[model samples]
Target: MNQIDLGGKIVVITGGAGGIGQAIAQRALASGASVCSWDNAPTAAQATAGIASMQVDITSEAAVTAAYADTIAKFGRIDVLVNSAGITGPTLTVQDYPLDAWLKVMAINLTGTFLCSRAVVGGMVQNGYGRIVNMASVAGKEGNPLQSAYSASKAAVIALTKSMGKELAKVDVRVNCIAPAMIESALLDQMPASKRAENLAKIPMGRAGTVDEIAAMALWLASEECSFTTGATFDASGGRATY
Candidate 1:
């Protein structure tokens, strides 16, 4: 693995317990960055010496605030943030989608991202250095037929990243997001087989992306090398992202 220099960086990854999030944590640790994983539950993977875990419900402002405080107390400062917490709501036409389900998905996928970002930006601004990598999806770029809630949430993430990036343009903080196509992870298990097949068919690569692949791009964005680009969308869609 190519290592990007992150010797003293402290990274906070939301949804860090998940497959992709864990992958990011591992890579960041490998590159010499101290990592803290924030998730609603503990991750199955054991935390190494340079790694820590915190239980946080991203959707709750109070919880997120407390998590940030804990993180700062432990690490002294936060240099990078990876907002990878999200859920793919059930596949259903908009007309038939349940309102409760929609709200739940929105709360977790979109609002959670906003809250976490909001909590960290101030610290980053104070420190005058930060890197934020939000996880968006190809579904946001090309709206999926039966996944209205998930698609819309991601689309908002893209827009949010752009706005935040611009707001922090004058500062050293850079905000960006990734639009990955169907990735082969536990997330795919949430979808029906038919839905999974449909998503795969849309990928020109004729296959799903891997957690490490997405993590690589995320690590690059979180590194000092990503100097000029902020509020930009990095595509990991495998020929699927048209724009």
Candidate 2:
């Protein structure tokens, strides 16, 4: 492994239950990092073998706050944070979109990042070093048809990553994001076949990206090698997003 020596580092990954979360956790562990898993559906028993698991609903401010505080209490300090929790909003137009679903997606995809980051800011500040990576989507860039709310919320996440990256760059803390194209995961399992195919057609690579691919980029971005590149977004569009 071309590791950055994360053995002694304590890393926290939200949505560490399935899909990319599990993949990222495994990569970090393989590189020798102590992981604290956060998710409502934490698969710590199954997905993670040695990682610490704490079940917490990210949308709830109190829950996320307590989760981070508890993590710090146990790990002593937080070196890396990856916000991977998200949801695919309703497939409806802006006018017909369900209010509840829109808000729910935004809560998990955007507000949850804010809540967790807020909870960890003090610990990172005291430690004088931190790495934060938020997960955005290519949909956020192109604005998927019939998925207005999801696209908008993700777009906000990208903006927030840039904004926070700049604000925290003055200190040792750095923030960034990954905007991935359609990846093969349960996130799209609920969509109609036609809708799913539509997304696949847009990817010039002619196939969906694997969870490990995204995880690899995430692992690197969370490492010390990524020091010079803060306030930036890395593309994982598989040749689809050439612009």
The CA lDDT at 91 in model 1 is 93
Candidate 2, residue 78: Cα displacement in angstroms equals: 0.9
**Candidate number achieving the greatest lDDT relative to the actual structure:** 1
Q: On residues 151-205, what C-alpha lDDT tens digit does candidate 2 reach at each position?
A: 8988998898989888888788888899999888898875778888998999888
In model 1, the worst 10-residue window by lDDT is 42-51
- Give per-model TM-scores: 0.98, 0.96
In terms of lDDT, the poorest run of 10 residues in model 2 is 42-51
* Residue pairs clashing, model 1: none
Candidate 1, residues 1-243: lDDT per residue as tens digits? 787998999999999988899899989999999999999976656375456999999999999999999999999999999999999989999999999999999999999999999999999999999999999999888889999999999999999999999999999999999999999888999899999999999899899999999999999999999999999998998899879
